[model samples]
Target: MSATVQTPTTRPQIPVTVLTGYLGAGKTTLLNRLLTEEHGKRYAVIVNEFGEIGIDNELVVDADEEVFEMNNGCICCTVRGDLIRIIGNLLKRKGTFDAILIETTGLADPAPVAQTFFVDEEVRAVAKLDSIVTVVDAKNVVARLNDSHEAAEQIAFADVILLNKADLVPAAELVALETRLRTINPTAIIHRTERCMISPTEILDRRAFDLDRILAIEPDFLGEDAHEHDDAVTSVALRETQPIDVNRFNQWIGTLLREKGLSILRSKGILDLKGSPNRFIFQGVHMLMEGDDGKPWGQDEARDSKLVFIGRDLDAVELKAGFAACVA
Candidate 1:
């Protein structure tokens, strides 16, 4: 006796959107809104921890970070392997969800997340990496961007950015902030909001990973240009508690840029100025740098400056000492 089996016919791949932002940048709030909103499309959300989802259903799964963590807070290493196992398992219950949403930890970099969908054999075969929707906190973004390189990387990789908590800042400041964000990531579409409110259509199914879309946004996102932090491209983070001398810091940065700008691809920081009540924030792309005064330090806020550098062959000791020289 002989038996014949038929393989399941392939269907249109499910769209996937990655939700990311700095801590307290309103991701969970936005996820809550997305779930509660009347979008009519069922969603599967994967997160690092389970909390405050409200809706009681199997749509949400807590992500077990079997993947390794990078210094900048990205979990892309083994995520494809994990997702392949999880999503493949989720497929057994096919027809239950129209799309999938992955909410990585606030400090995560979306590059690795996006890469998983493009390279994983089983994952890409069944699911498409739709877009990366990053949430930015209007009031606190300056500090967060200055302190976390992941924040900058998030903006760099986003197809859409929900600039939430817009009501907290003035229109002029918001405009200025948007301009700076654009300079850092020229490709992202920015949407201003209060309390994470926005239309679902704006972020979902953007096909950010499509070759045409990627070429339109930034051609380097897919090929050898994608930085894996190998020998040619590397990253480092520096932290200090002492307030920096604004003028001295500027001079030091200017000289560094003049000397090493080409090798320095991205630089970002939130500085504690010796005499200022407000935090001084700044970020740079190559030789271009911009900065502005940020929210005043709270009565009890900790005053620490964090700086991250991603570039080619950066001399950590020299750079660290030069930065330290700017301290008061």
Candidate 2:
């Protein structure tokens, strides 16, 4: 007797795009462009502001979360924790919006924010990270790139880069900026826009990030020893076949972030938990940490935990030991 086969259905999750750039780098303008665009997709905007006064009330589509004002004037530094919480809450109201666009403050690096999609279990389950779209100010690209590590990383990790305010720069200068950006990241799709205006299709669902690309960017990431790069950046990856103690893992994460938040740029992992059949995901940028349950394990799935850390001058020995403490 022949058996009938049922086709698998694909339920596509909405993607969340994190828009970041240096201060006054046209992030807001690009956001406004997205909001006002005639495109049919509805987006729920999460605005992280530096000051208590919210000036762009007219631009906000729906104020789901109060503008989380950070003390440091940098969204990555001050509002990262708030971002995790907001995203978690947003996931609960999944039917209300088609997609999510998070506008980070200038001076914020995109790595930590991107890490959230991989680490936080709840956020990961509901929202897939679509892209890290960095808007570069064409006129001041050289200066910002020279002065800020955050600016450089934003460009480095971006899947799509918008050279905004292109009209302000000469053609030759813009070309030079493109060359510089290529050296930092050769794979990102570059778009030159005037006043941060570009087609929405150009930015969304680009699938710019890949594990292989990330590993290539930090080759020593998977190595056993700690490797430090320029600007005191370091990467370490931990892998284990054993499960982790949930309580110990939570404590270690809190302590590590509290003490080394400034130095820790990004950390993420798929964890094997003692009592959980599904994979547990953990991710953080600076002080913000988020995790959630991942897909269920199949009969042939490998039960192992793999975590990667990228930061400034991180001590590999100490990190490994701390992670080991979480072992069950």
Candidate 3:
């Protein structure tokens, strides 16, 4: 008789949802609902600040929360190490839980967390990115978007956006705010909810992540790791319709970051390069910057260049003048 070979069963990949938003944007409320709701699936939650008396821990049900400190107070720079370690350990207990949820600090940029799933081979084998869900404060999101780069990033990276506290704002204001959100991220699905009350079907197991869109937003999705942290960070936004001299902009930004990278936390831009059919996207964390060509410009689309810099004591005039000098 011939010997029979038995094949081992493959374990199903776990789904992970990254929860984020600006401070006081009802993230904790949403978290509480997710944990307490009778969704018939067990979830292991990872939080930035685990056991603080008055914060998320108190509101959540009794469960083990993994706490990790940001390296040099920068989530993008530091989370990779801790997240990989935590997730590696979680895989050992496979089949005990149905999914994983990560709630980031209000100031965090979700890009790094999302990058982890794609960067790590072990984690990638066991877990699949479900979506990035952002909770927004309907009354204050506009102001936050204007002043905070983190707030805008949370919105930009989200696959699902929760416009929380909808009762506090008028219908007209909500409409306008959502319109503004679309300009920043046209692909996300925005849901209006009060006190974060929503059906589980809307958030969990949706499998809404699109890697192609992420590459469009972050040109170097698989490239070098990024890091950041600072006090009194300010933002400068520049927009122009005319094509820019790529050589001039490259020289200027390279010199500027080399000289002043310490003060700058983050810089990002989408450019209409001279004589190019495709859009140019670039992202920088401190001194390290990367860029690549993005999707081709639509025939009817307005060809515009937009850039934003977030840092401490930014000289808006100098940055604007430098960008203006790059116009072709």
Candidate 4:
């Protein structure tokens, strides 16, 4: 006669928040807010290597990445070996952090990252994907949606969306944008924020990842459907040693937007502008752009200009030529 062994009714599972947003959508701002808030919950953050110089990582708490395609060549049905290994190690000393946060690169489709939670038995046993929180640039999401599949997928996969930079847009536009978001992801909770200033409680520990609902929406959330990335969309990183001529840079950018704004999804740069001791940081989505003075150059800091562009059918040579022409 053998006595039945009772398995533990409940096991401790760490809550994870998968944070996503398109380029220049202020994901790092939201992430920084979450980390600095006195919410009494410590989080182990994992950020993707965002820029050529790790500028985004420099703004965040930590960083990491490694992606692979499954045997079936479906890009969406993929996994990150680094993610698994990191989480596995974290699980060993789980008490150190109360939760985990994964901030994906701007161009990333959250499907593969979210699938990691469902596909890995070891990770699944110890971690619960609490929710997918997407930070949207309220001022630019409309333009983004028209040209970016990743942007649309990010919205579709979100459990909560921060309609960030709401103050930048008019109220009527905000209402219309919210209505548009509802059409894409009616189930997600949308919160308006000027700078991702929301209670951590509202965004964290929600236990809001509804797999059944996601399946009903995506049917293939578990990756039965073969999907591939849009090879047409590409990123270009440019570096310039000489300080850029402000007038030349503006004229060139304006002309470029006029000629290729439809293909240009996003653009960002930290510039060493002629006659400015401070760093000029600028980011744009399609025809819209904004810029402001960043911190003054440190005594030992490099003053070289670094720019990145993500778009469809971008001409690297033409872009490089144009950037070179901006040198002061």
Residues 1-328 of candidate 3 have per-residue lDDT tens digits of 8696544456678999889997688887788788778878888777775423333222222323332433432222323556777888877875678888888878887756765665567887888778889999999987787687788778766778999999999999898777666545544678999999998778888753332333244212212212122224445567666899999999999888877866665576788999999989876656556678988889998788877665667787888889999999
Q: Residues 176-223, candidate 1, lDDT per residue (tens digit)? A: 787666555544678999998887777787752321221233212223
lDDT by residue (144-250, candidate 4, tens digit) is 88787888768766778999999999999998777666545544678999889999887898753332222123212213111133334545667788999999999
- Candidate 4 Cα misplacement greater than 4 A, ranges: 1-10, 51-64, 71-76, 208-328
Better of 1 and 3 by lDDT: 3
- For candidate 2, write residues 229-308 as lDDT tens digits: 13344456676678999999899988888788777766667788999988787666666677788767778977877776
Candidate 3: regions farther than 4 A off:
1-9, 50-79, 208-328
Q: Candidate 3 at 248: error in angstroms?
A: 26
Instruction: Give the Å shift of residue 217 in candidate 1.
Output: 7.7
User: On TM-score, who's better, 2 or 4?
Assistant: 4
User: Any runs in candidate 2 off by more than 4 Å, and if so which?
Assistant: 1-11, 51-79, 208-328
- Model 2 pairs whose backbones collide: 119-282, 119-283, 120-290, 120-291, 121-291, 121-292
TM-scores of the models, in the given order? Answer: 0.60, 0.57, 0.58, 0.58
Query: Which ten contiguous residues of candidate 1 have the minimum total lDDT?
Result: 69-78
